[model samples]
Target chain A: MSENLIPLEQLQKTCLYDSHVALGAKMSPFAGFMMPIQYDSITVEHNAVRQKVGMFDVSHMGEIFVKGPEAEAFINHIFTNDIRGYEPGKVLYGMMCYPDGGTVDDLLVYREYLANHFLLVVNAANIDKDFDWIQEHAKGFDCKLDNASPRIGQIALQGPEAEKTIIEVLGYKEAADLGFYTFCDVEYNGERLILSRTGYTGEDGFELYTTNENIVEIWDKFLKAGVQPCGLGCRDTLRFEAGLPLYGDELSPEISPVMAGLGMFCKYEKDFIGKETLLDQKAGNLEKKLVGIEIEDKAIPRAGYPVETPEGEEVGVVTTGYHSISLDKSICFALVKKEYSALDTPLCIRIRKKVFPGKVVKKRFYQTNYKK
Target chain B: MSKILDELKYSESHEWVKVEGNIAYVGVTDFAQKEMGDITYVDMPEEGDDVLAGEEFGALESVKASSELISPVSGTVVLVNAELEDAPEKVNEDAYGAWIIKVEMSMPSELDKLMDAAAYKKMIGE
Candidate 1:
């Protein structure tokens, strides 16, 4: 069967799916679910989050809970980050790697306020794979793992005015007290809710994780408050412009963290899966480096396009590219050979039959507004 | 629902052709542009490049997807719309107004093979 002919019954729906349809959003398939691609123009929705506030129905994300006395040790064993001695309410971003130095998934590890407990928020597309990978490593550990994806729903309120919206619009006074990368569990409408000061967009924002039953009410509340509802369209451009990596594109089984320029997240002092290989790559010549390429032309470089030297020698491929709505320049994240990954190095991108001249530059095309 | 102009002829691939004497003005229809959203780039052939009926001559790229611009008539490209280089969104603003290329027809008979606005409307289930 053709990939586009996947039966409508085969796709899944979030708790707020009806709300999205009612808003006249353009629906498209994403991660085996019928997701909203856009409501208004992507550029319009993008500017809303950058300047004021916008909300997203990110209920498609996966959540897993780890409990028991050995939870911390279990996490550190599979994860690349050194999460030791971290205080409760802290959320750290890292990845799980295979024994061969391949990435399983990049996720956020939240240290729950409860003792010996943690919450793992993973990408929507990798939910099943990530759950199975974590279970496989849970062989002899004294930790209990639970995939809580089906029961959970998430909403991200993002922008400079996010906190104000939560405080004034939603009447959540405690939201103003949360710091970046910190979360607090509170009760809302007689139900349990977890509010975290974390977001995929580089903007300052809050992610509200609650029961599937309660999320519908929260989404409707935001709608009543007149907050712009953002779809996955702008969500991607925002994160890409902020230099954040998407799992399948930037980091995959073949594209290791070392090659993706994410060595900072992998601590050499820690003993974890794929640490030795990452250490070797750190001390040696990496096969490829993820760098930013900017073209003077309006032609956009997309994924799978070839990156070449000025003399027309193939160097690498673009993982993600866009005619940056914020910067008004055509920029892309390309995985080029290590020799050609330096700043101001001249390169060319083969977009279709034509080649556009460009140069390697910093990957952060748009500066993040995260609260430090 | 996409607007279908009464006079322009359309190809199965959604390109519309407006003929004046030996010259043919070619561009994507309103339906095509509406589906493509905001067009960021238009890749077109140089002036004087020959184009054949039902053959690809250029492409239109949006943020999420790319669509090929198929020619509906056989001709030599007389002019390429240079305005789209900076304002590709003009295609989305007015698909009929943003003519991507103009071709001096070498085989005017190919124009008869294209569907009139009524047939194209029925083809798109209007």
Candidate 2:
């Protein structure tokens, strides 16, 4: 009927495309970018980074700067986390929710300078929505918000050797004392950069933020210094093994953070948008509960697949699914009926045309490495 | 990788079966496991399960994906690899050594429908 191939729009390239291609990486589409899924093999790359060290291109994440006389109050009113209580150089993980209590995006709020400004790091896919949301809510406040994503370059040095790699690269003795979730200004090649002791992978790591002009030099320097070049495939497996949720699969517009097992981020004491609906749901009106299921048989649980009770009644759907390299099982996270949220409950997933039996396990299939 | 001993038969899906008298031994090809990444779980039919030629009899779970195991010939399952229950990675480590199940072939001549190692290799673009 149509001669046109429904031509796909050109994809935006990252700064590391050539580098990844040279390493014989398998590239795949992710968040609108052609990203490397694996270099040699997913398992080899995953174990290499976990046992040693690795680096990830994290420039895709969105960063915003909020500054002004009313920055503190404005941020406190918007974020679910208590921004008023955070100290300078501290980062707090939280979410921005809609008025109806649905999560817009989970973000990390970094208190930069004393009460004057702060930085917010958000997921890559939600950058536009996050920026627009902040602007729409800033009409009555005296705060100024700026989308600094394009200008900023980010890299994550992760694994057991993360601290040593970052300290050596930046040549900062004070960086050794940096605590988890804390950031500090560092001088790298005469350029001042913000280095935070935080990362998405379940490893001891640091996320470095600097100008785009200096990022290529930094990436090259890290690779030369033996920070193994890692790809997004390993990143996904590492985070999944650590039981962290990906935004598109775990955090969706229709799903609430509470239903995703992140209710601790929601605060009733704070008078913010989405409070009333969340409060009503918290009062026992919630319908579905997120549960983690591990397939007892060999069948894999995949996203969008139907999950049902042993008796064949549809209970819910799989949100995220994968085989766990660490646990040696096919694991999945599903939002099932509240009554079926019990641990160790037998369940079945309809994959293709066959029914595979599974059982609910702990939300975290693997132990997290975050320092308390 | 085991010698795809010429006596055995293969399927396009990468399964290999060796028939001796009325019994057969089944295992996946080296290419199958390597392409599937790390094997986390292997579901095998029980000792008394019935299998039909071209019908799926079991499944294999790999990191980030899952695959089905189809029968090469109609038979009754006589033995299964119980070791896979604890160490499924063995399949990835050595696919030929980790034979999934053994069966008593109903139609021994059905093996003629399968290809040899050379033919199977060509189909997968080896």
Candidate 3:
């Protein structure tokens, strides 16, 4: 049967399901998995990461492995980022796009311990579609592709104190020395685990990739140590505050990385899928671009709200928005007409029956505190 | 489990009306506020605006989404809860006490169409 026909009640659950329930988490279905939306509260969970340390069960994220002598070439053919000289244990954040430059999914490609073997972490919602796309394009690549999503479990330990917490709680002291965007394999309970200094919250953190049983053990250790168990609700707000792009919201099939102000990740030197169209968009007059808007009123600007010019011309729509928990301002990321996306451009957000005045500003609402 | 006042009339939309002769006080029910979670803003109609029965008068915004506030009786808005503009959390704290608006009933008989507290409880599966 097709994926869509699957019933909502039959949604998958991560290995940490019982832990979340025991902690009084509000469970909701997201990306085909029954995930925790909030544990104590969104505000509390969000502040925990911003102030101290928190862990998120990111097990629902899919992991696909590609291995062969031609793995790097095959990855370069599908990915926008240039990974030709990437050393083992390096991680590159990039997108896989359709031939027409539309996004398939924004993902992280991790060079594994073994040479010529790489792991791709993709959004859970796009697992089947992305795997199918990868297989369809791998016909002539002389590489093997394996969907290892179900077998892999992931957790992100995030915040300023994440390094200390990981060392004290999980007994993974080597995590402290791992460079940003880099991963290393460490033995845990007689099994190898991948620990990477990467996170979506733009904080100093590390993500752990392991088996379900090991992940459960790690979660128990964190729980025993009083590390905050964050849910998807705060995960979004934290990532939003850090100006990270969510796949569906910021980079969709219609919204390319370039249009989303993520052109840096799209290396033009590499000949990949949609490279021609991306180069054309970079050189030519683009129609729309992503920008940040700050409203003067306390009234929040939410997703799908219409963005208009002072003269009432519809220019864009909000993809994600919130009365930011940390900043305490009503801000949003909007895809607006190219001409109207410049900083300090006065705009109006049509929310409900009234139009509130706003100004286009830097997309990064809050400064990120990543340990370089 | 939210408290339902027996004296108040309820709308299917989860608004409560405390009628006093021809004038009625309108507010979202406790159950509504509980479901909304962390009320951030309450958009209310200005005084003297006509609010038709069973029509959207304004909206109540929570942290996650916005919910439309439907008027249970046809009336002209006489007073809005101005405090809600700055302190919307009052609705979440005390949904029954934080009345949203006061309306002069144009069709007093519209109250007949509303459910009593007992009916409202049953409707909510309480």
Candidate 4:
């Protein structure tokens, strides 16, 4: 059977299933894995990581290996980032786009040591399609791109106390000084792997990249050293709090970079796909703009819900929302009309049958701890 | 594995109905609360609102998702547990004690359709 048509009932499993169960994680289906949504209360787990230390099993993210002579030019053509400036051990946050300027996937491009090869970490759901897309785009370039997602495991150690936890566990001195977006290859149990100061949560953290064979052992060590196991429930809340957009929500084939407020990542100097259309959209009035909202009422603004002004005029729709622990208020991201995008502009959300009052707020609902 | 009091009746949706004269106290069974993790918000019916039997009166929102609070015995809502407005997690902590709403029954015979504690457990595969 084709991968996309596989029934939801025939879902795949992650490597940490048994460990999550042992830690009392509330397991649920997310992006096709029976992953942990939370161990304790979602608020408690969320606050714990924001204040102290927490670790997440993010192995579900897809990682692809792109190498060979034409790797540099080929990757630069597909991604929005200018890859020429990237040095060995440096990583770049970029989005892969279709010829029409629609986002295929947002990914982290890691430059490997002493080579033009790059490691592209992508969203799990878009693995197969992304691989095919890259292969199709490799027309005249003498480059080899391989799907290495299934063979790798990724663990994120995040939060304010992340540095302390890392030093204590691995005895790696000066690891904290490795600036954001920089990584180093280190030996773990005699196995060489990469450790990058990167995370989804808006906190000081490091992501351990290793082969699938060594993942279980590394996870066990982290657990033994008291890394609180976090799940997807808090993961969603944390990213929302940080004002990070989910792929299916803030990005899709229908939305352009200008409307999504991610035009800064698009390089104007480069001749790549979809430049003309994006430039046109950027030059004109944006029909919809992503804005952060805070609900004064008890209603939670979920996706596909209609957003309206207090006068009951249809403005836009909510992309994602829930009871945000960091804000201590109901928060949501909505793509509203430019007129209603100003900060503190009052609006109303239609959740189910009830209409609740809300206001547009500045992005980053909670202060992020990303290294400056 | 909880002690189900006989006076309370249960619904297939795992809500409990405690009858006191023509009024009934409605809450979720311990089994239901355990399944819905960390209740964040309880959308309860307001006073004077008429509810139908086996219909959704309100919903209990959890950190992950929301589940409907189905009425076992329909009636006019006399009062909602005001305490839940401030501490919705109380439902997850103690389901039976944290009755979501109280209703004045329009048809008292609606209680007859519910299952007692023993039958409710059997329905839950307990």
Top-scoring candidate (DockQ): 1
- Candidate 1 residue A288 Cα shift, in angstroms, is 1.4
The sequence of per-residue lDDT tens digits that candidate 3 reaches over residues B1-126 is 988999999999999999999999999999999888788888888899999999999999876678999999999999999999999999989999999999999999999999999999999997
Better of 1 and 4 by TM-score: 1
Over the stretch A1-372, how does candidate 1's per-residue lDDT look in tens digits?
132576888988999899999999999888878899999989888999999999999999999999999999999999898788889999999899987778999999999989999999999888999999999998899999999998999999999999999888768888888889998988877888998999978899999999988899988988898889999999999999999999989999987888888988998777899988888888865788899999978888999999999999999999999989899899999999999999999999998878999999899889999877
Q: Give model 3's DockQ, 2 decimals.
A: 0.52
Indicate the worst ten consecutive residues by lDDT in candidate 3 chain A. Answer: A1-10
For candidate 4, write residues A1-372 as lDDT tens digits. Answer: 133466667777777778889888877666666678888777877887899988889888898999999898898888887778767989888788776767888888899895978889999878888889889998899988889887888888889888888889877766777788888888876876788998888888888888866778878888899888888888888888888878888887767666677888888788667676777777874577888888886657888889999999999999989888777688899999988888999988987767889899976888889765
- Quality of candidate 1 docking, DockQ: 0.73
- Which stretches of model 4 miss by more than 4 angstroms? A1-10
CA RMSD of each candidate after superposition? 1.5, 4.1, 1.9, 2.2
Docking class of 1: medium
Off by over 4 Å in 3: A1-6
Q: How far out, in Å, is residue A365 in model 1?
A: 0.7
Each model's iRMS: 1.0, 2.5, 1.3, 1.3
Predicted candidate 3 versus true structure: per-residue lDDT over A213-269, tens digit per residue: 999999999888999999998899999988999988999999988899999999987
Ranking by DockQ: 1, 4, 3, 2
lDDT tens digits, residue span A1-372, model 2: 111322335544567777778887777666666677777677777776678888888777899999998887787777877777767999988788887777899999989955688999998778989999998887889989999998888888888777777768757666678888999887666876888989887887888888876777888888889778778878887887676778777776667777777877777777777777777777767888788998865566888899998899999999878776566577888889888988999988988667889888887877766544
Which residue pairs of candidate 4 clash?
none
Error of 2 at B105 (Å): 4.1
The superposed Cα distance between candidate 4 and the true structure at residue A102, in angstroms, equals 2.1
TM-score of 4: 0.95
DockQ value for model 4 = 0.62
